[model samples]
Target: MPLTLPLAELEVGKHLYWQLGNLKIHGQVFLSSWVVIGALLALVVVGTRKLERDPRGTQNLLEFVWDYIRDLSREQIGEKAYRDWMPFIGTLFLFIFVSNWGGALVPWKLIHLPSGELGAPTADINTTIALALLVSLAYFYAGLSRKGLRYFEYYVEPTPIMLPFKIVEDFTKPLSLSFRLFGNILADELVVAVLAFLVPLIVPLPAMFLGLFTSAIQALIFATLAAYYIGEAVHEEHH
Candidate 1:
């Protein structure tokens, strides 16, 4: 007799491919991402459509979320610079938070694909790396734009001896950021799938709950770090 594994085992590393002219892309990631984006936009639209002195329903929720993201940015990026970058930071947080939770909670497996099934966009290495690279670009742009040529002086701040490490940090920042999010999300999904495969019922519930919690935390951490990086770049040095 041959042993067979159940579908509950889950496909860990597969992607739905779409050909766009000559370039191939992950279809499922985009599909799920679009869903998340649409949901976020709809929420924003509905929430802001009617603004009142006394917030109600979705408006109240929206205001609370806005305040939370604002505070996070203000605390990390400072009052002067935080306002300029709050939208970017908030978008990152909301997008990642939705992607992570949606991937975990939604029954994506119900919607089958030719190759890969739908999951969190963040679970994909390409998506996380792209986001990480964007953050890297943002900080560099922020520094140079705000400080002009003086931004290069950051490499030597505290002491010229720090130049080598600062240069290396530029490379490490994105690498660390991308891998951290990617690894955590991938691990969480895999853990839940494996537990489901083994027990097929009640056992996976706890892991699923924990995954949701971690998902939210990861979003917050990513946003906070992004804001902090920008703040550090634009921070003034006093004589």
Candidate 2:
């Protein structure tokens, strides 16, 4: 009998082939991050198309998520800023929460595709980096919109001596955000793989449950920090 590895351990480079040309796309393109993002956007659009004052079914579920995210924003960023940032914050939370859970629940190993496995979009580093960039840009735009030219003044605030450290701090936010998510999800996936490999029967069950908890916590942490960054960007300094 050959050694069988879990889907989590499978590498795309070995299972999928890519053509090298100006217009050539990889065989795994369908399973790529863009496809997942498109699917998420489509769901959001379809769910919102037939809105009702009294929501039901998918609409109710969407509304529930929205309310949860709104509450999170209000608590973390305050009411005045929460309304303005709700859509961005809400979208981030929904996308991450869905992606994390979906990845764990989906039977990527059972499906045979060009890609090695059909894991969640959030499992990809590119996807996480893109999300972090969006968060960084959101805060940048919020800061600019709120403070105009004064946004630049934030760096030199308290004292000119703190300028260099403040500048570095600003630059590190996105990097930290991107890596924190990527590292946690990757580790979770790896643990799942190792456990499944060593004991295929029932040993991996506990780890799966733990992974779900960790995934939710990571998503919440990411969204909370994002809200905090946006709040910091737009907050007025006390004299």
Best-fitting candidate, measured by lDDT? 1
* Cα error, candidate 2, residue 151 (Å): 1.2
Model 2 weakest 10-residue run by lDDT: 24-33
Models 1 onward score TM values of: 0.96, 0.83
Per-residue lDDT tens digits for candidate 1, residues 126-216, read 9999998989999999889989999999899999999999999999999988999999998998888888878979999999999999999
Candidate 2 similarity to native, TM-score: 0.83
lDDT of each: 0.91, 0.78
- How far is 20's C-alpha from truth in model 2 (Å)? 8.8
Per-residue lDDT of candidate 2, residues 1-239 (tens digit) = 37764553557334355566765444443364555567678877878999999887778877887888988888877767789998888778777776777777766677777555666667767677888999989988988998898987888888899899988987798889888887887778778877887888789999999989988998898999999989888887777
* Count of clashes in candidate 1: 0
Off by over 4 Å in 2: 1-9, 12-50
Candidate 2 lDDT: 0.78
